[model samples]
Target: DTVSYGRIFKADKQTRIASVGIGYADGVPRALSNRLIVKINNKKYHQIGRICMDQLMIEINDENPIAIGDEVILIDPNESKDLTLEDWAKLTNTITDEIICQFTTRLKRIEI
Candidate 1:
């Protein structure tokens, strides 16, 4: 879910961020740390800092006003219009198939 980063000491800046409940433990490659981007409400936002065991934070700008349960697009699988699994493959210097297969049992799949 979304969080305001470092509220105790860094409250002045009020950097909005979303900490997704998926990370290296969920088959997310560690190489994607600080390099991945996710889409929220069709707008792009870069991931910030290192991706942890079970979460990754995306920087949300001031105007976006993201909520706790807003949809987050991790990999679209269609590179023509948005970030895709292949994109992540490139970032990790691996193949798309590996990228697709790397996701662990920790994730839940929903069929459309």
Candidate 2:
């Protein structure tokens, strides 16, 4: 089945598409739709299709043990340098501070 608002992603076979609880409205760029890769359980998965206002979708294999409450990391500097704000800024052709500031209050901020 196709996924997201524009149906931009279609799996080659039957696959699980997990809807992450954050998206454009949460400061995730729409331009990062197909370009973003999120980490879950130390495994990276591509953010597929056109990003929605409140959520995005990721393709998951049937073999993956990901569950509803599993943590999905959008930008984890410690995990992978590639997942940092600087990388996202480069991908979106913007400054890191701009990217950082774009995130809305809808998302919960946790200081580590």
Candidate 3:
């Protein structure tokens, strides 16, 4: 993602911003930079800023009622709510298989 992707960062009252504890070192594509999305409490939020080596930011809604230690959905099969690997694949212009392969040991895969 380019610098312009998060050039103007602003969070309204309705939006709750979160900094996730995962980043490019954990295989988040730098290309996703600020052009990616994550799901929290079954709602989609835009990822903002350059994806770091160990973190990224998401803009959730205050109405969604999020808190520290909430389980965030990154890649999921829940098409109606969670973000899928295919979504990241499209954002990074890569295939789903490649996206899956890029995941590193820093991440713990959990199924719910």
TM-score of each candidate structure, all chains considered together: 0.80, 0.91, 0.77
Q: What is the lDDT of candidate 2?
A: 0.88
Question: Model 1, 77: alpha-carbon shift in Å?
Answer: 2.7
Task: State residue 75's C-alpha deviation in candidate 3, in Å.
Answer: 0.8
TM-score of 3: 0.77
Residue-level lDDT tens digits of model 3 in 3-112: 22355454444545688998888998988876777777777788877787888888665566888998877777858433778778887888989988889999987798
Cα lDDT, all candidates: 0.75, 0.88, 0.76
Q: Please state the error at residue 16 of candidate 2 in Å.
A: 1.4
Off by over 4 Å in 2: none
Ranking by lDDT: 2, 3, 1
Error of 2 at 5 (Å): 1.5
Question: What is the Å distance of residue 66 in model 1 from its true position?
Answer: 0.9
Give the winner by lDDT: 2
Tell me the TM-score of model 1. 0.80
Candidate number that wins on TM-score, 1 or 3:
1
**lDDT tens digits, residue span 1-112, model 1:** 2332332213246676667888888888878766788888878888776677888877776586678888888888654543887788788889989987888888888999
User: Model 1 scores what on Cα lDDT?
Assistant: 0.75
RMSD (Cα, Å) for all candidates, in order, is 4.5, 1.4, 4.1
